[model samples]
Target chain A: MSRTKLDLWVGFFVVIGMGALLFLALKVGNLGGSNFTDTYVVMARFDNIGGLKVRAPVKSAGVVVGRVTNIGFDTSGYRAEVTFALDTRYQFPRDTIATILTSGLLGEQYLGLDPGGEAEMLKGGEVVQITQSAVVLEKLIGQFMFDKAAEAPAN
Target chain B: MNGLLNVVRLLGAMVTEAIWRTGFGARFFILLLRHSGQSLTRVHLTIRELYFSGVLSLLIIVVSGLFVGMVLAMQGYETLQRYGSGDALGVLVALSLTRELGPVVAGLLFASRAGLAVTAEIGLMKTTEQLDAMDMMAVNPIARVVAPRFWGGVISMPLLAALFSAMGVFGGWLIGVVLIGVDEGAFWSQMQAAVDFRFDIMNGVVKSVVFGAAVSLIAVFEGYDCTPTAEGLSRAITRTVVTSALAILALDFVLTSLMFRGQS
Candidate 1:
């Protein structure tokens, strides 16, 4: 092949190779847990979403069993409505509480479901009445700064 | 006080003259609109340029992305391991690559490699009267010369950015799984759990597209407007690189602000 032809082939393969690698990365990076036979939706209400994006994981007893599928605001309640899909097999009682929790000091927020031992199991579309909203770090920092400023002596 | 006042007056007069004679602000806006139209027209030429800029640069980008990913994963793993949270390596790599490293590094690389070449080529064309020759033939030089490259760069940059992010993630996965002994399944699941398409990848891709347009337009503008002299060509090339690089950074800041504007 001519030099220009060779250059063209090389360029073509480079793009192809890069594209293949990208495909692989996306595939491998997006591997979710094994598919479950039964799943149900759980709803929670929060005062503030607090940087909680959709698809954030929902965990129960530190095990990820679901994910936040959608988030919206309820006009009547004046609160953010977060809906999460959970595996049906992992049954929670009607009295179970859901709280938004962060993994670490600087980590993504996830829904944490605390299962309560009760005879009745929570059904799909049932709202988790006890909900703890997200604790925003910036808000905490701002409050700290405000408190310090208020405590300072007047000049 | 009098001296300062005179200095201020002189500065105001210079600004007024510069704005009027050079038509600085209006010229730039008109140039932007015209170039945008030109860019839209030269689709085929832009594709060819993309073949060069996006495809040809993949090797270096992949190699560099791989090592950067590996290094990031190793460091993150070591740090997280102390807290027994080594499983979070995938999340770390994915978030970092998508948000920051992917676009910025790929943009810098593209600017350094193809950006300078593009400026120099156009500068040479101006210095050698090639652009003038096109003009003599009644060809619109801006449409012919500058538009294709500007559009091409715009098209190519996002592809390269995506390539960079992908390779970097792969590199991170390799280190996390193969080297660090993290389970491949867990590593991937962690990534999936952490990253979302819109927040992570799309953000970088958008930034890349904007950076591409900025770099190419600035470089081509400096080159095409170069004075017909060897010294002028050199100066133009230098200015093109410096100005394009600065524009890339400045635009990135502005774009970031606009993109993340109501979100905390």
Candidate 2:
């Protein structure tokens, strides 16, 4: 009887421990990083999204304050439009410029917002008119190769 | 022409005998099922066996699972960090534990510990004429001895697999967050978002059930056919462990291939 009781207790503890661990993992990993609520939406148009995926961080003055929620193409504009969820607390002026910036030399792409001094704040669903597209690495590489070839011939 | 005729005759005889044995085995299975109604009365006996086998084996399983999880997480973190994608650790641990390590490791451990004991016990009964005595008393030995054990193992293996998976994931979390200073919240949430209960838990349980059936059948079959001697019993036990472990691994590979053939 004692052995049976002990067995049951052990089984109970194992189940409880597992359940707790699963709960903690879900709560921490998913909810902590990105707080989508209390955030407004803004749209930016680009020729290419590049390596920018959904949930890519959006930064303002080097601080992450939002994330990219959706990326689609505008048939009329013939441009890729990225929808961003921005914190409502940070009011973006109408003249703010949104640029796709790389975090490092070989890092993920993020949307960086430059707030311009303006009295009117951009509201939800408003498009940020001043948008800088992602830097095309292929074009940069082609230019570098061309410059190298020209310099080598001259030398 | 004469040599070819002899070979053809031998092949025909072998096929005939094989078919006859298969039919006999099928009939034996049906008879065992008919007698399986007695299993309801033997539930207590099965539970007792489970307590001794599964519950008693918890410490070893937990310790091993914890270490395996920790090692996996540490290695996974290092590799992911190299690619600057350390955030994907949760997915890595969850997927590995659920799909691969959980059932295979638990099955191997169970085969080593419980499989040997079961084989030896049944082998001893066969050698001691205890099985013959049961038959004389109008008791079907397979139904009474083998079926209860088979059912018990079938039930216990899944529970053990679940326990192993849970412990392993916790171990990974401990290594990732407490020891390695990963963002505790991020690691956990990523694991949750990545692992679905259907894909992880269900997959593990299905593998465990198949492993349980294979282990129990192989162990019981080996024991039942053992030579009536002490040395034979020892050999039977050794064979049981080896065969069950191998069967578990082979079945795991087959199941994994079938399950994930088109998915990835």
Candidate 3:
């Protein structure tokens, strides 16, 4: 084969290979949508964070506004301390409630923010006082069974 | 009692031979690295080998990847639909291809095709006394012949693996969304949301690079160290494929453990 021809083929191979990598990064993976312009960290404490993992979406009104960055156990409060980075464009008042909610019957858990009527806007490093824990199915079922037994005796 | 003693002697000799060959392979690798400057200086040589090794193997890599991805979608959906999360077929296919199958399968194929060719080519050159002629003329055959092929295999491997993964994801999309009536929005969104670029994709690239280095080194060393006979050349080629395959799988396990341990 001619030198130029071989070079052309090799060049084509390299280009296609690189194109495949680019496609995997942008299309197959989440490289495009993950870029946030500016962000601030907000901490919320939950009594329980069942199956809540790091990098889960933090959504408000069913739209993702941030990502859960860190999850740790607060040693003093005996609660799950969840930290998330919210886009600067979206802000909530000091009374916003952070609730742990599941997507579907069996889907990933996310943090949902419901803003309350408050004049003060929350800033970075401030902890949201009102938070809801992830509801455990076993606990809910146990409570339901206990209530049923108690009512049966009364009946 | 005599038979048992002979068996013990044979076992000891095999162990010693294995250790000696391993040491020789390591030294050959170091020597190849030292002489590798010429392979880069004359870029055309490496590019030529790249054309032979990488471009030639593209067809098998792409077709196999597509079939693998389609099969993964079929199998993944059979189980996922039972749980009513059939939309997750995209995630399952993408994760498996990018994490495990992409590098492993591509590496194995590259070993069988390009690795065997490299071993045979150099073995033939040796059997023909061409290497001896080069040495008599004060020319280093390792630099002129071996290093380019070595670098070519090393460079082509990761690129081929990446292409395989991309083709696989395309295949999964074709089956899941185009053919089987999966939700288009949910399929892509779930895949993108689940497959992290840094954690999954880069780790795969790392795995391919390691596999490439191992397979390339094994191929070149076997070629360089073969006994320079027809039978010796046949054994060298056989050893190249078998060793490369085993090395790829074993190194993959080790790399996966180190890279993804406790990640879940």
Candidate 4:
């Protein structure tokens, strides 16, 4: 075979190989999402995080704006300190409510943000004070059963 | 008693020979690395070898990947549809191909295709006294011939594996969304959501690189060390394929355990 032909074929092979890698990174994997945008770390302390794992999505009105960067126990406050990397484009008020919510009856949990009416925007490394813990299904069921039993005699 | 003693003696000799070859192979790899500069500097020699090992193997790799992906989608949809979660087919196909099937299957195919051929070529050179002629002429055959082929296989392997995986994802899309009427939006979205670039894709790349180095080294070593006879050449070729396949599987298991154990 001619030397030029061989070079052409090898060059084609390398290009397609790299193209495959690019496709995997962008289309098949999550590299093309909001990861490219500048993000600010926002901290929230929850009493319970209930299977809210690291890298879980953080959504605002069901739109994913960030991801959970870290989940650790707050030894001083007896709470779970969940750190989020939210996109810089979206700003929430200082009084924004951060709640741990699940997608379905049985699904992975995510952190939901409800922007508050306060004029002050939450800055990087700032903590959102108003936060709700994940709702434990067993605890919810137990409380419901207890309330129902208390009302049985009256009925 | 005589027969039993002969069996034990044979086992002992086999063990010693295996150890000897392993030590020799290790030395050969170190020498190859040291002499690899010549191949790198020349550039074209390595590129020529790449055409032989990588470009030639592309067809088999792509076809096998497609069929595997289609099969996985068909089987996954059958099970997933029972629970009405057929859309997860994309995640299933993508994850399996990128994480396991892509690197492992491609490595296996490469071993049979390129690895065996490399062994055969080098063994023939040895059998024909070409390496001896080079030695007489003060030319280092290891630098001139072996290093280029070794580097070629190593470079071509990861590229081939990546192409295999890309083809696999395409195949799954063809079968699931195009043929089976699964939701296109859900197929792509869920795949993008589930497959992490660093964890899944990067690890697959790492695995392929490791497998490539292993297959290339084993092929060259077997060729260089084979006895100069027709029977010896055939045995060396067989050993190359078997050793490469076993190494790929074992290394994959070890790598997977180390890379993925702590994550939840």
**What DockQ does every candidate get?**
0.16, 0.12, 0.64, 0.68
Tell me what TM-score chain B of candidate 1 gets against the true chain B.
0.84
Better of 2 and 3 by lDDT: 3
lDDT tens string, model 3, B172-221?
88899999989989999999989988889989989998898899889988
Candidate number with greatest lDDT: 4
Candidate 1, B139: how far from true, in Å? 1.0
Q: What docking class should model 3 receive? A: medium
Span of ten consecutive residues with least summed lDDT in model 4 chain B: B255-264
**What are the TM-scores, per candidate, against the unseen true structure?**
0.69, 0.63, 0.87, 0.89
Clashes counted in candidate 2 amount to 8
Q: Clashes in model 1: which pairs?
A: none
Each candidate's interface RMSD? 4.3, 5.8, 1.3, 1.2
Error of 3 at A153 (Å): 1.8
- Candidate rank order under DockQ: 4, 3, 1, 2
lDDT of 3: 0.92
List ranges where model 3 is wrong by over 4 Å: A1-3, A35-47, A68-98, A113-131
lDDT (C-alpha) at residue A143 in model 4? 99
| Candidate 4 accuracy as TM-score | 0.89
RMSD of 2: 8.7
Residue B99 local lDDT, model 4: 92
Q: Tens digits of per-residue lDDT for model 2 on B1-264?
A: 999999999999999976885576467556656766766675665665676567666777778888888999999999999987788787788778878898899889888777777788789999999999998999889878866766666666777776777778788888988898888777866676555454455676689889977887667667776778999988888888988988998999999997765332
What is model 3's native contact fraction? 0.80
Candidate with the larger TM-score of 3 and 4: 4
Candidate 3 chain B: 10-residue stretch with minimal lDDT: B255-264
